[model samples]
Target: MINAGIIGASGYTGGELMRLLLNHSEVNIVAATSRKLAGEAVTDTHRHLKGFLDLGFQNLTPEEIKSACDVVFVAVPHGTAMDIVPELLDDDVKVIDLSADYRLKTAAFEEAYAMEHRDPRDAVYGLVELHPEVAEQNFIANPGCYPTGATLAAAPLAKAGVISSVIFDSKSGITGAGINPSPVSHYPNMAENVQAYKLTTHRHVAEFVQELNRLDNSLTNISFTPHVVPSIRGILTTAHVFTKEKMDVDGVRKLYEDMYRDKPFVRVLDGSPSLGGVRGSNFCDIGFEVDERNNRIVVVSAIDNLVKGASGQAIQNMNMMCGFDETKGLWSAAAAP
Candidate 1:
């Protein structure tokens, strides 16, 4: 069995990691760390994982975790992974960081995020469908939740040269902000409301542009807008693109279906998929409508912010890194409301 460890194991992503790893047959969860709940039973803190992990949360040093596990998942904040990933690499432990630190290859984007690129040489972007090779080779840089949904929604058309330019409008549940309490997450304020918080300056903009740009260098123009809805989980991405040539709805659908024919996680839907349909699974459900009237295409994609967006994708990377089935631990279906 491959030994696994989770650093910064108290947040939503960490908790989801624990839940998925519990059912993962090939993984032996060696350590789960949390400064606040160190030495406490992991279940005591995350009631959902109470009986799954009998071990207590340990406040472990990088050396300690390196010695105990074959791989370490750095699920900390954007600026923090740079510090922990380097030390883990020193011990030869494959690192899968779920942060913005290593996602973008361009140094300028790193500066825009306000975090210095410490180990710029080691990390790889971990969008499993697009960068399966990265998962096979070295340290993985898991894509942000919004980026995952948005990129998958548009990549097929971009590759086929079906669309000239893409505009992505994504809405995510409040949990996408993290477990921290903020004025934006105030219960009264968030309830019965839908607000667009990060209009133009959201950092994921760099990631969306960088990934699509990599696919087709000529595809330059991309517009992205993200909003925070009152719900607790899931992300829905709606992309609008103008086709280079007039394409029928069935033709566009066939293009997407053929693109994802071999991919297990991305599902193309006939009708609009609800957030709850993909809430607890790694699937990115996509559906589209071709506006023959305006010669445009509108596509919608949905994923659980914490699952496909974070922990589940992290596990998918682990499966690829360790030569296990990509859907091994992620075979469970989405939660139904």
Candidate 2:
């Protein structure tokens, strides 16, 4: 069994990593670190995982983590990861950072995140379906929750080089902001309300552009806007993709089917994908329609923000990097109503 460790194990994503790893037959969770709750039971903070996990939160150093684990997942915030990652990588232990710290080019990262990168290197972008070669690397940089859904919604068309421009309007749950409570996540403000933030300047827009551009270098007109919905999980992205040529419904369906036919987690649905269909699961459900009159393809993709979007995706990366089955720990079905 692969011995795994989680740094920053008190946040939403960290708790989620603990939850998923506990069920992985090939993995043994060795350490879960938290600075503040160092001596507390992990279940105290992650109440949902109380009965499932018997581990306590420890305040372990990078050396301790490297010694105890074959792999380590950095679940800290974006800027924080850079500090811990450099230390973890000094050893033979595999590192998977669930942050934007290593996802972009060094120059692009400094501009979008507005922080100088201390230890920038080319780590594989861990969007498993789009780039499965992660199986060959020991380090992976996990994609953001928004980018994962938005990119998947339009990737096939982008790769076919049929898209001229793309606009992604995404609605995400409050949990996307992390476990920290803010005025936006305040129950009074978030319940029954949909507030749009970072209309044209959200940080995740950079990733959507970067990934799509990698597929079709000439494609550049990509726009993204994000909204906070009242739910606590999942991101539903509606991609308004404009093509150079007029395409029919069957043609578009074939493109998506052919692209995702070999992918395990990306489900091409007959109808629109809903948050409930993918909540609490490591699945991205995609469905689309061809607007022949307008020459636009309306594609909808849904994924649990905390699962496929974050922690579960991190575990997925770990599975690949360790040469285990991609779906080893993630074989469960979506918890839908």
Best by lDDT: 2
Name the runs in model 1 displaced over 4 angstroms. 90-92
RMSD versus native structure for model 1: 1.4
Q: Cα deviation in Å at residue 45, candidate 2? A: 0.6
**Tens-place lDDT digits, model 2, residues 1-337:** 8899999989999989988988899889989999999899999999999778889999999888999999999988888888888788844689999989999999999999999999888989999989989988888999999999999999999999999999999999999988888999999999999999989899988899899999999999999989999998999999999999999999999999999998999999998999999989999999998899999999999999999999999989988888888898888888878
Q: Using Cα atoms with residue i matched to residue i, what is each candidate's TM-score against the true structure? A: 0.96, 0.98
lDDT of 1 by residue, 166-236 (tens): 88999999999888989888898889998886687788888888888877778878888898898999999
Error of 2 at 128 (Å): 0.9
- Candidate 2 has an lDDT of 0.92
Q: Which 10 residues in a row give candidate 2 its minimum summed lDDT?
A: 84-93
